[model samples]
Target: MPKQAMENLTESMFYVLMALQRGDACGAEITAYAAQVSGGAVRLGPATLYTLLARFEKEGFLTDAGTVGCKRYYRLTAAGKAAYEGERARLQRCLDDAARAEITAPASLTKGDARDETARQGNRLPSGSLPVL
Candidate 1:
């Protein structure tokens, strides 16, 4: 079966959009900025960077700012900025959920302990409850 297309931004896509947040950048500059901003955690290869650039441009999320000799500069359009912000908000929610879960969970319970408890309870609605449509 064919893999379904991603509906949300991937980590690399998020970083690439972020790299263009400050201003227009060439492919190499975007990669460098992504690495620098991520504190060396995210690195974009040449192929992946260019491919994203092309896709973003085609999607109307980015615009060609200009070209300098062999390098072409790209900047985020309004849609791109919105997409970046949306991804940022989604990531923040994930972090917040993890933090809240950690704080509320008993210290003695290992990560697996919580899962085991839920499994023991069974994956079912309460006896008198009807599933929401």
Candidate 2:
């Protein structure tokens, strides 16, 4: 059976592709880079990272660059770079549209948004505290 082309990437997939932009990296290095770049917001566990690596390689977006010891490295192909850039642009457009809508939106729409949440209180939560609605 033929594999279908990916039309879009999920958040983790997008970050993994973005991580490769720094240079060729092995699985551990890519996971570290993604975490560092995302300020710990994205954590790629071993299983998830390996799955993505295998899938991207199959999709022609990545290639085996080298292997050192047990760790295999991956490099982005031209198609991978294009995929990253395309996803970035798509994300940017989504943000742009949201910004435009926010500006034109009626006041009620943004009342539950982050800005309001912040203003509701210099009311910051403590470490590990769940936010109060």
Candidate 3:
């Protein structure tokens, strides 16, 4: 399969893509679910989320199915699904690599080793010294 362009996606865009992977959802529900899933780490404020959603919609990553009030419901297009899965896999590998680098580093390395590695990768360590996403 052709690889998807997931590396260009922002964190919120990535989370929103993953949120739509399982099923369709309106804006509010998507934000709520993403926030819950990320344990409030990935905040999808209205302006940011909807704006990205609009871009994703335009880019054929998501499709508008219907709306309730001002809220628009969306489902992932085939491309969107593929992108989401690809991005999820990429994120998983990043997390795995970070964890492995931290664990397997020499004993002389301290907590700063793990924290610095996480920072170098532009990722924050998840709560309890774990990766969140």
Candidate 4:
């Protein structure tokens, strides 16, 4: 099936919406929020940030909240909140699903036998991350 925009919010997309939960924010503020929330896991640089902001604004998930100089501000719409909350719920379910199962990492993965075990599989989960079966 052909994909639809925002069908599944990317980590960056989710963070953009989340960053506006408190109030309005500029591009820089949103990027900082994403980095803070993801423990530096998700970084949205200018190009990526503006691209997402444009897409979100186009999708009705966000609205322009005026601008200061060259910095444009945005506010999360009701739709945006719904999208963010939906992603949150979906992630919670993932954790719940993982919790109900057992994870066993093979020696190869545990010993970092490969170039980057963590990158290859979630078996040997990195710090602050979930494991793969």
Task: Pull out the clashing pairs in model 4.
Answer: none
| Best-matching candidate per lDDT | 2
Cα lDDT for residue 97, candidate 1: 96
Clash number for model 4?
0
User: What is the C-alpha RMSD, rounded to one decimal, of candidate 2?
Assistant: 8.6
Candidate 1 residue lDDT tens string, 1-133: 7644334798899999998999999999999999999999999999998898899998888999999999999989999999889778888999999999888877545566544665588965567975432
For residues 37-104, what per-residue lDDT tens digits would candidate 2 score against the true structure?
89999999999999998999999999999999998999999999999999899899999999999889
| Model 2: pairs clashing at backbone N, Cα or C within 3 Å | none
The TM-scores of all predictions, comma-separated, are: 0.75, 0.76, 0.69, 0.72
Task: Report lDDT per candidate.
Answer: 0.86, 0.88, 0.84, 0.84
RMSD of each: 7.4, 8.6, 10.6, 9.2
Candidate 3, residues 40-69, lDDT tens digits: the string is: 999899999989899899889999988778
Candidate 4 wrongly placed segments (more than 4 Å): 1-3, 103-133
Q: Which pairs clash inside model 3?
A: none
The digit string of per-residue lDDT tens for model 4 on 40-82 reads 9999999999999888888898999998999889999999999
* Better TM-score candidate (2, 4): 2
As a whole number from 0 to 100, the lDDT of residue 83 in candidate 3 is: 76
